[model samples]
Target: MTNSLKNLTSILLLLFLAPIVIATIQTPLVTQTQLPEEKKKEETPIVYAAQLESSPIATEITEPKKAFVYFTHYQEAYQPILAAKGEKVAVYHPESNITTFQEQINAQFAFHQVETEFLENYNKQEIKEYNTIRPFVLNALGHNKYDIILDIHRDSMKADVTTLKVGEESYAKFIFVIGGEHENYRWNEQLANNLSDQLNKLVPGISRGVLVKSGKGVDGVYNQDLAKNLLVVELGGVDNNEQEINRSIAILAKAISNMFFQPIAS
Candidate 1:
């Protein structure tokens, strides 16, 4: 009686314990299989947060500064270039004039990521030409804001006064002419001084210096009274060829960019 009872009890105990042991092992296996999926869910927000942090970089892009360039004495031409074209004039030409510098200026400014707007139209009447261009300049200033306004011109002087040699290259020298008659002329003078300093720093002696004109028979205001940022730039004399002038333009554009834009990291 005792043996039969012992065997039956042992068999029943084994059947019950077998199911419990199998259930415990299978539960751990299910958890192990699901761990990767659970970890992926937990890490989803971190990946999304990284993308959000980087998204603002696209929107943080800065716009370039703007410059307005216009020619008051647009008919002023280089003698060497005009002579090559069979023109007899030493300083003045109806076409092939100082206004042609606008192309090189625009290209150099673009390379530095500075935007330039040039106004080249003007009347043929050399007398009171600044008066004729004033309305157009005022109109341009009204429509758009400019960091600087340049009235590009050519000097009537000889090449000795307007050309500079830096290292081995010859550069057409420039001078900043600001009228001192106006009430706010000092501001224009300061701007000219800053630009002249930058130019000379880039290419030693490239800038002849800032000239202030205010007296009778000198067009004392030179239309600079209209804006604090306006000034006349005597680019070169009649003798400087296109190559020298173009090199100077590149230096000037770089100076302008250095003044207005953020410095690039080394």
Candidate 2:
């Protein structure tokens, strides 16, 4: 055979073999035996929003830091929640109903002086209660020398997907909502931003998102008053089971503990 013919034949042979050779080169299969030791995490329990205490990590994070939390709940249906969670209620007058008592009541708020340094330092404390949010906060602030005032409320939303999952159980997720329509809009949004960021980071998708609500129903403008570092947290909604809501709080306690003690910004 001519040298040119031999060269052409060799080239053709190489081209044909290339396809077969390429087929064998593949990523090593990650077989069952080769899989990592980490087991798949269990799904979170799906339960009611009102019963958010299913997660036990709740109290581990709350360290009596001159903080006061006020909930805008109807007097008739909230005591059980208060008792189960080991939360204290500073009712103005035990004889009178909280929701029915229209007159504004005030109290001083604070933690023990030794631990007072952990409390927030308010630049101003001129609280006015012409609306819903203020009265509840004023009452709490009256009794404790608290720099941080949190106005709490329950949410109401359809729960097709709002159901939050964390470490083998599903619970109603808490949404930190702020209303931009109010005067202290930026500060309010910042607090909500901090909370939502932490919850979603530690347990992805547990936060519904920061809502800038406007209009009448979202009343209290949402208590963005009292101080710059106010928190308005919506525990859970009607669609969420009570247990789920409780667990969300438990997760929240961990987040709160981190915010106060571990300043590693979520």
Candidate 3:
């Protein structure tokens, strides 16, 4: 045949064998079993996980602080109907009953048993009650360096001004009265503010906020100069009954417990 026809046949034959030849050339390279260990490791799929199963988890629990509570106006009864002969007797004597607040606190916290009641109205005379109470507190402090001191009293305001409703319970709302005359006033204010915040969280409006007093018509210091955490808490008012005051007390105990107890991460 002609040279041109021969060349054409050769070109067609080369084209048909090209793929086979290319496959043969790459077969050994792809099928090679000897790969470096480092190269194989680089090609492996990564598996990520933390080995924290053995680690201990943290608990949100803590110990309570040492605390004390007493009524300076022990006989300053609520809603006085008639004035007694300088004895300061009223309708309700918180000293006789509401000492249960301190008892409740004792159940959940480190509380000093300082349920002192002065038969005479020491609160009547300018600073007589405070003077008497301060010495007792100083004595109490000598025995136990308490972290918190509460001088509990009922306010003279009406029920409407001092009552608050939390969920299904109606409570006598309380206020923290800070004596600004003391050098550690800020410390007392901080504690009061913290207690107020915690109480409001548990029962909104249960806290009437902190009231500051100093100078005329009132005992400014209220003997709060004795300690940094001393607070004069006015619980409810004249219209608040024993039950309402107790309800407030229970809630107050919880709030105080929470303020002193703090959780730490493990």
lDDT values, one for every candidate: 0.78, 0.53, 0.65
RMSD of each: 17.8, 10.7, 18.0
Please write out the lDDT profile of model 3 over residues 1-26, one tens digit for every residue: 69999999999999999999999887
lDDT of 1 by residue, 172-260 (tens): 89999888888999999999998897787677778999999988888788888878999899998988988788777877877887777
TM-score of each: 0.72, 0.55, 0.61
Question: Whose TM-score is greatest here?
Answer: 1
Candidate 1 ranges with C-alpha deviation above 4 Å? 1-62, 120-128, 262-266
Tens-digit lDDT track for model 2 on 33-97?
64443343234433223223432222222346554555444332233244454545332223222
When sorted by TM-score, best at the front, the candidate numbers are 1, 3, 2
lDDT of 2 at 181: 70
Displacement of the residue 35 alpha carbon in candidate 2, Å = 9.4
Better of 1 and 3 by TM-score: 1
